[model samples]
Target chain A: MLEIKNLHVKLEDEDKVILRGVNLSIGPGEVHAIMGPNGSGKSTLSYVLAGRDGYAVTEGSATLEGEELLEMEPEARAAAGLFLAFQYPVEIPGVGNMTFLRTAVNAQKKSRGEPELSAAEFLKLVREKAKTLKIDADMLKRPVNVGFSGGEKKRNEILQMAMLEPRMCILDETDSGLDVDAMKLVADGVNALRDAGRSFLVITHYQRLLDHIKPDVVHIMAAGQIIRTGGPELALEVEANGYADILAEVN
Target chain B: MALAKLKDDALAARLAGLPASAASGWLAAAQTEARARLAAMGLPLRRDEYWRYTDPATLNAPEVPSAARFEAGDEAPAFDGIDRLKIVFVDGVFDPAASDDLALAGVEIERLALAGQADIHWAQGTYGVLEARGQTPVARPFAALGSALATEGVLIRVTGQATRPIALNYHHVSDTSDAILHHCVKLEAGANLTLLESGPGAARLTKVLEVDVGEGASFHHIRVQGRDHERRAATHVFAQVQAGARFKSFTLTANGRLTRNEAVIDLVGPNASAHLAGAAVGDGDFHHDDTVFVTHAAPECESRQVFKKVLMNGATGVFQGKILVKPGAQKTDGYQISQSLLLDEDSQFLAKPELEIYADDVKCSHGSTSGAIDETALFYLQSRGVPRAAAQGLLVLAFLAETIQEIADEAIAEDIRSRLEGWLQRHAAKGAT
Candidate 1:
């Protein structure tokens, strides 16, 4: 369950406004895809919800499970079950991928007052999850995202999402640099995690990814606001004819 | 010149307080030569090009500034887990009761005080030879001072592969002790040895370690400068590596008021390899400097210089490194990189990297960079549920990992890593976030 109402945001260092009073809500187990043209504030919405820096939420609120997400620190938001799959995953030269994942998992567990996983337990679980994403031992041993290809990076993000098991997941342009096969693999991983207690906000530019993991609903956004809301067919319409027809009609 | 007169006055004042040594025969001759050299060069001054980034006032002062001994608090001393021939020193004086027997299988070891009294010995040829050679391009008056005035040290001669490392453990007790020590190590042809040194010997310390790696021999040196925050030290490592020989040296420095570690390595034979690396973590009131010069004189030699520093809360770090490839030294591969991770705007890092190649076929590359923590990487880690401080600590360790990998021994590397982790945890509690 995720909710965003009248979400207005502006760059912290500049006066330029990005998201302007956008409203969206997703219920439990539901998958929603947001399609928008360039600079329409689709990615900004995800960043604002995930509590990223460089953005000032001028007005409105975004909540996860009735908890104010914007007011919490990024780590607290994560502990409270918010996950953001970045378009370009950061490449950390020194921190190994396995170490990063383990630290994150244990940190969340400790913050939640749950027992931390032993090294053996963690290794087993991560290996199982990685198997589905086709991430080998070497990938897990290497530094996070350092020298990783586009497809590998996206898949690594998916693996992290699976490991963290956040209640609400936001994928910001996860399909941008991935090939069709990689997209399908990532979609399968995401589909396996879909259940009654989990929700997804898939922000994409095309309908090709939606084809792999069918969405329950689709929203067409323009100029910082959601101009239209429909079913999966809305994504098909956008693919058939670009956003030009829809933007002109909405104006 | 006014600069020369100032240096002369400073050197004279500092030399007036030296503790007298009863030198004789060959040792007396060496000490006399070293004293002449010091008198000619004088102590370093702030205006000198060599001491540009770091001030030499405190190191040049006559009176030793008192340093409070650090209570490591339940942390095991460095290299305690390794099997080594322990030679202990307290306040720069050899502690025979605390040291092991002066005997090892493949090496001949003797104290400098005992060996200097002998009329003739193998160490007489190397006592200050490397130190004098290292003073040519740069005037290291502190090293000359140590060689001329030191009353205690160790002399080691290796003729075969050493079964275990030789550990020089320094324990600081007297707050006002001014310690000077000189050590010489000669590795015979085809021999191998590893030397380990640790601790803050005294309030104001000057140390010189000269090593000669003979043809086809190998020498490995690892040092962990003590954690006394108010201590000031000037340490020098002068090494000459022969043909087909190997030389590797690494140092880890934590908190100290002032620390200058200078390493001068000369590769004189073909196919010889040398590596010099250092990792330092400094907090407020800390100043750490690593000055290294490596020379390649023979064809097909390789040398690498890697140094990294982590500074926060107004701490300062300096690096001056140079690599020279002489004429006819074709196929020389030299690499140098110095980097700093400044945790805040108040901290500063200064670096100067130089490469001189007379042979056009040589490949020498050098890089120097100072940067803040990668914000994107930090945010990514935080997004995964790691707290801000823990994430930063991880990144800092990662930054130092490249330099730590230069160590040939895995156990020693692991020990160093744990020590760094302990340092990070202690500082993190002081609001590193």
Candidate 2:
């Protein structure tokens, strides 16, 4: 469902490269977890696929469902069913969370030549989805991410992913600031959305989150590229003995 | 010396043939007195200290270019369906034929024209009294000019709580009309009133509003400068807040070639409070300025000034606000904030914020900022599938939301908000192309 070959990316404002010659592939219905230490180009790979600016794909090709992802704008990418649950969800002061989600849902639908959900219809759908994630209706009424606790923000991100129902989803460090309870809740939300047609690329620094939402495959990333790829046992190995042995083996 | 010479030259070229006649009585004498002061002080020049940022040439012309009369679309006019006393003015002349009678509960209202040609009345003293009082620290030549030539207005006196708001609705009919309007409001102790003003009065409009708020009185003013894209107007409000009085005013301006709104407020009694706020949206060739001066003369007074402007595509905005606390006015609270959202690289904002304090134990703060939209916020919205221009429009409305909240009346606030939203929607469409 997703493919990247020889992807090399450098900061647009600087010459230093962040992602160099990374190759990855995920099939439909597969949950792939990318475990890496800090600054290991795991998040960079996700950002490059989601079409964020400030990075130049110097040499690489990325496609999703046979459509090139490198040439689309961020919104177009989202409309093309690409979702990125940011590590630090932005706090937009003036826009209410409900308004933001509704606009986003309608926009994606319109881009895909579908009818928009009426206000009443949208409200009902959001309430049902929010109940599962344990998000109070009050959170949706307030401005987007403003004054929300870390757990609430993560839960909100999961709610957005469920509502968008993207074909390919990337969760960038969704477990960084979450407690164990919050992690389990987030994992449950993600597990419920998993299907034969939807795939997820979860990026994390530890295997704590993988316990709840088991991954089909695990990749250990060091420096700028994926150095090793194996079955779910790879995550357990990385968790048991940090990334040192893997780095030595790759070198 | 240079200012004097420049002022003199500007006066000759700008005020050569404007009518300054009034009824033959003390009112006329007051007009003559103000006219004499205007001649001496002259008009402000681009080189003047206060006029440094905004050029006065367009407003100082002998003849103001006529703006195409605005025809409001199917949208219900502002304050529609609200209980109000509608007072109409066409081309700066009172149109009683289309106005409600001056009958209202707890209030006495009279047209300035009724104090006919040969009599001295109560309005004679208040005609230019406050305008002259404000000339002490700053020379507001335009305000003095408004007092000198103004002939079309009303005098309203509130002795108790007014049941309905008074609406001053101006309608423009003449293309080259030059209008000067002066309104005087006196509220007795413990009285309450709300004033609503809207519409494009003329091609070139100058207005002065003087309010005498007695002890424990409450007054509110909300005005929407009409959508005449080529209109040139300068309006001034002079207010005196007595002990424990409350005065709050908010203005929402959508479009105009040039508009200057000046307000001078004096907190004369202990515990008095005053808030002055405005929100303006301007497109290409638009220029809007708000100059406010507030004084704390008695102990424990509080004052706030909040001004926000959104300019796009070569539009310009200017703000010059000052807060002064007198000696022995301890425990005074003064706050001032002026901000501008420049949608593009070419738009501009100029601000001068000042605080002059003589009291040692007072809290005063002021800040000004001019910037483009928050790029991160814009991206966050756009990344959610909202179009780029729509995202920009949302940010602009959010930027102005703070000022809109200053309105004390919820219904009026909602009306102003929708008006701004409508403006943003239309402008966003224009920008998209």
Candidate 3:
């Protein structure tokens, strides 16, 4: 469902290289987890795939179902069924969370030539989806992520994911600021959305999250390249032995 | 030589062309004093310290190019939903055909011209008196000019709680119509009243409103400037608060070629509170200014001034606000904040905030800021599929919501919000992708 061939990315205004010669492939219904250390270009891969600005893609191409992902604006990418759950969800002070969600949903639907949902229909659907994520009505009515706790923000991201229902999802460090219980709640939410027609690329530094989401394939990325590929057992091995053995093994 | 003291050619010519008013006895004496004051002060020139940020050329023009009459029937006039004592004025002339009976319990209302024509009237003591008193610390010659040439006005006095708001609805039907309206309001001790003003009176309009709040009384004033794109107006309000009194005023301005609103407030008694707020949005060829001065003369008083503006294209906004805490006024509290959102590269915001404190035991703070939209928040919204223009509209409304909440009444706040939303919808960019 997604392909990245020789994707070389760099900071737009500087010579600093972020993603160098990165290559990855994920089939439909497959969940791929990338394990890496700090500054290992894991987040860069997700950002480039989602068509974020401020990056110079000097070398290669990334595609989703044979469509050039880099050629679309961020909103166009979202309309084309690519979703990125930010590591740090921004706090928007004025826009209500419910209003923001509805606008986003309606905008995407309009772009795809679909009938827009009525206010009542949108509210009912959002409430049902939010129930699974433990988000109450108060959270939905308040400004988006203004004063939310770390765990609440992550859960809100998952709520958005469920509502949007994108075919390809990229979760960038979703487990970073979450506790064990919170992590399980988020992982369970992700697992429920897994189906034959959808796929996920989960970028994380720890093995605890995979313990819950259970990826179909695992890759070890260092510097700017994915150097190792295995199954769920690979994640367990890193959890037990740490990245030292893996880095040396890959080199 | 005294009459020749008016050096500015434009102001002198405008004053020379005033229509006759049947001012006799004390009313005539007051008008003569105001005329002398205007002559001495001349008109506010662009080089004047207070007028540096906003050029007064349009306000000083003898005859500004008349604006095309606007037709606004999409919805009922702003406060039509609420039951009120509606007094209508068409092109500065009181239209009895369109007005309700000028009768209400707990208040006395009279037209200014009728009072002047009468041999004896209560306006003898208070008309233009408060405005003359507001000339110190800084000179407001336009207010003085409004007092001198205004032949049409309303005089209102309240002794108890008013059951309905006093609404002034202005209708514009002439291109070259110039209106000068002065309103004098006085609330007796333990009284309560609300005054509402709306519509564009004329292409070039000058207005003054003076209010006095007695002990233990409350006064509220809410104004919505009209949406005529080529209209120009200058309005000044002078207010006084006695002990244990409350005064609150808010204004919403949109789509005027030139508009200036000035307010001068005095807190003369302990425990009195006053709050003044405004929100303005202008797009292309619009110049909006808010100049406010607040003084705390009595101990243990509180005052607040909040203003916010959204400017797009080549529109400009100006704010000059000051708060002064006099000596021996202990435990005084004052707050002032002015902010503007510049939607494009060409829009500009000019602000000047000043605070003077003579008492040591006082808490006063002031802040002014001008910034573009939050790019991070913009991207966050855009990333979730909100189009660029829609996201901008959301942010613009969010920025003004804080200032709008300062209104003490929710119903009025909601009315202003809907008006602002309508403007944003109409001005949304074309070819938005």
Candidate 4:
């Protein structure tokens, strides 16, 4: 389970509050969609939850399965069954993708005191997961995210989330730069990883990705706060009209 | 003896007492000239600009007597399966019995002293000079010392269209338990040679190698300095490359108490190329210095210099590289990069890369960076269940892999990698215990 209680976060080195009085809760087997206009603090929520540096938590708390998430390091948060599918993955030159992914996975397992995987076993599992995501075998051998297309990088992020099999996954604008086919493929990868004991919080500005990944709850956020929560119809309503109507009502 | 008290007469007397077999007329004249120069210049002090980073006083003492003869009947130098002509020099004396006949179809591999009589033009033109255009006062002492005590060296000649590579193996072993100097190596026109020079004992040795690359010729020089723990060694390599010729030199210094490998390369002809690369790793109380000077004297010439140093424990390492472009050397492309990784806070590294250009149309750049291993990379590895030591070792290995990637020979590169791993393990264990 994941819980965000009146979370108030600000951009680093500034007094500008980005996420103000935000509250959300999602249980096992539930998919929550957070849709908002530009600068609505959608990506900031993901980063704050992932414990990235340079984000000041002005107030409130984030807890995952009763463990404090904001106080932990990014790597520590990752080891505690939390995964963030970055919108724009960083290109780490000279660090092989397979090497990077294996390190991350084994790091989580090591932190949990799980047995480490041998090279052969790791390769077998990685190849299987990569095949499901349609990533080429040679891509694993290259530097992380180096020379990858926009769509490929997004898909690679999803592939990593799947490989880690986190208990709670955050898909931040996974469909922003993708074409129709790429959007379908990415959504399908996320759908495949969904399970009864796992949760997903898919954040986007459009409803196109939701056509493939249906969510149980839809929340509309504006001015750093979630003002409306409804069933799946809320996504259709925002898609048909836009955020202006919702903004007028919230104001 | 105090270098100030070292008179020409005393030097000449010592030179005269040397075995006749190791003496040559040209060598005798060089010793006289060097002694005269040393007398005029005197020994360099710590205040000298060139010796600022390195103190020559540690090496200054009464000159030890030259060993009478090289200790013979030692184990042969290990080749690790690389096959080429082997020319052996033991204790500054040519070892004909240990040397192979190296009578390839069109190549000739012989001692420089013997070649002086067989082919006077090639030998004299190659080994005649001891001029290093930009050498400093600090280097003057060692250069003068090596020149004053010149002995046998290798002479390799490859005729036109020769396909085989000539390997020159120079090994120095101390039999008289004293220090000795071996000077000069000459490679002739159209010759393709791979010189593998190794010093494999606890004897104090000093050697100077001079190479002449004729027009359109190619030469690859691989020097591995592996001296004993107590031995103090110094190597000076001077190379002159002619039009359209290529000179590639790689030096690896892994063990020594006080070692300096200095290389001076002159691009004398248009379109000539020089590739100079070196890796030096020092542990414990060892001190290693690699100084390189590359001069672009002709238009359209290209030169690259890369040096990497890894120091552990209380060891110290220094890399000083300079790229000089002459006025008329237009369109010259020269690049130099020197990087150092200090494994611990106690280890120290000093890197200075300089570029001086007089040509208006030239692309010359030099950069020097020194830092510890990446902390993020370290944590990334350790988080993956790799023990702390193994993680650190892997990160360090990857850090040096950039330099190793430039090696032309994969097998040689792998061998160097294994040696580096072994070194890391030993040092890590020592640190652990």
RMSD to truth, every model? 1.2, 2.4, 2.8, 7.0
Model no. 1, DockQ: 0.88
- The clash numbers for all candidates, in the given order, read 0, 0, 0, 3
Candidate 1: stretches off by over 4 Å = none
Summarize candidate 4's per-residue lDDT along B369-428 as a digit string, tens digits.
888876645543433334456556666666666667656666666666776777677667
Write the residue-wise lDDT of candidate 1 on B102-210 in tens digits: 8999899999888888788887778889999999888999999999999899999999999999999988999988999999999999999999999999988999999
Query: What C-alpha lDDT do the candidate models reach, one value each?
Result: 0.94, 0.89, 0.88, 0.73
TM-score of candidate 3 relative to the true fold: 0.93
Candidate 2, residue A98: the lDDT equals 95
**DockQ of each model against the real complex?**
0.88, 0.62, 0.74, 0.11
Q: By descending TM-score, how would the candidates be arranged?
A: 1, 2, 3, 4
What is the fnat value (0 to 1) for candidate 2? 0.54
lDDT of 4 by residue, A164-248 (tens): 8889999999998899999998999999999999999999989988999999999999989999999999999998999889889
Give a tens-digit lDDT track for model 3, residues B201-320.
Answer: 888889999999999999998889988999999999999999999999999998899899999999999999999999999999899999999999999999999999999888999999
Per-residue lDDT tens digits for candidate 2, residues B342-416, read 988889999999999999999999999998888777777766677777777777877887888889788888889
TM-score of 4: 0.72
Highest TM-score against the true fold, candidate: 1
Identify the runs in model 2 with alpha carbons over 4 angstroms from their true place. B71-75, B116-120
Error of 1 at B310 (Å): 1.0
Worst 10 residues of 4 chain B by lDDT: B64-73
Share of the reference A-B contacts seen in candidate 1: 0.88
Model 3: iRMSD?
A: 1.1
